[model samples]
Target: MDSPTNSQKTVSDDEEIDYSIKPELYDSDLDDKDEQWMAKKRDGRTSDAVLSCPACFTTVCYECQRHEQYVTQYRAVFVVNCEVDKDRVFQPNAIPSKVGKRTRDSEKQETGSADNERLNPVFCATCSTEIGVVDIEEIYHFFNVIPSEP
Candidate 1:
């Protein structure tokens, strides 16, 4: 086997190297496993697509999928109780309501203690438009939302 020579050296002592990187290597924090995870998080309607707010065309979230626990489907729209991996949500783009108690009006009829964290309304950070809801399971359900290519 040929050994790497000084001329073939790609990184310097001051530089960092992580061979486990995949495509979009600029995101050093993620690896092949993360890519695979993101790939698996696609929905039937919008496969590996970017989700945006229909009102203001603001970018809301991306690579979201239908809720695994309860699969829902809406007419004309692809997302039915859409959700993205917790790590994929861009905190600045997707705004969620403050932690509070779950209301009786929630989709699920189950009630919990006051201290229990409740589902939250998610909005577009830029437009403050109602985009979806984040359930107690921490899944984002996009309603009347638009999907765009990444």
Candidate 2:
């Protein structure tokens, strides 16, 4: 009859009902990008966070500039592009995932719901910055940055 409150439950409200001990479920201030977000340093702290392509220095992901290595996980892990949800800013590669069925199946199971999906390299449209790897559907982006680079 009306815009149901927490009383009249639905699929969308599974989060509100599940009382699991998932810390993320409780903390409302977590960003999904913290895992793969790194910062370009200037004065010990990440003062220059313009995460451009290391090969060409072309700006690809402008959002990376806003991410800080001090606060976030800063591990540079692979994440579902859906988790990033900043598709407009990212640039998916023209090529497609060339791996075999085994890898594809594994990737799908890892991320889930990416049926018939494949991954591709997300290089800098302008420079040599390989931001990460993403699926053809832009569903998953694998980006694991080491501590230092050439």
Candidate 3:
């Protein structure tokens, strides 16, 4: 998807894309698996394919299935180039965040409280379909995603 604003360029379906780096790569912080994927991209042996919401064809992100889960638990990137509406939330992960070493008691003490930590749900702006989750506690971005496939 092309940015509605002209400063950003849209990629054609047939085009061969090579981004210096995808934002998600940094977001994940690069595990060994992620590093391998990066090496492949650098060598021009592989590239990411566009992953979009099937319901509305809204481009959600560009990713390689291999490099996925490098940063987040699932192989989805929330801070993707695609457009979404934050207001139209539907579902949330029933599971709680299992951040390391912090017990329920510790979480309450460390950050003042665990209540402040939040995971944002991503929805399709056009169809309101839930696509992914964002960790809003640290900042205004997603820590994980469920990349939609057509």
> What is the number of backbone collisions in each predicted candidate, taken in the order shown?
0, 6, 2
Q: List the residue pairs that clash in candidate 1.
A: none
Better of 1 and 2 by TM-score: 1
User: What is the Å distance of residue 66 in model 3 from its true position?
Assistant: 6.3
Alpha-carbon runs more than 4 Å astray in model 1: 1-47, 66-117
TM-score of each: 0.36, 0.28, 0.35
Please provide, for model 2 over 53-123, each residue's C-alpha lDDT reduced to its tens digit, 9 standing for 90 to 100: 45654433323322354532122322212133234344445547566645566766775663345445555
Per-candidate local distance difference test: 0.54, 0.41, 0.50
The per-residue C-alpha lDDT of model 3 at residue 74 equals 34
Clashes in model 2: which pairs? 36-76, 53-129, 54-129, 55-128, 56-128, 81-139
- The local distance difference test score of model 2 is 0.41
lDDT digits (tens) for residues 1-150 of candidate 3: 654876566778657655664756365544777767656644553334435555776655544343455543333443344344446443444657676854677656775533455555665665666655555442223323444421
Q: Of the candidates shown, which would achieve the greatest lDDT relative to the real structure?
A: 1
Distance from true location, Cα of 142 in model 2, Å: 6.1
In the range 1-150, model 1's lDDT, one tens digit per residue, is 999998997877546756676646366655776657645754333454567677778756655554455444112223333333333333335536547965455533354443243446566666667676565555566765776654
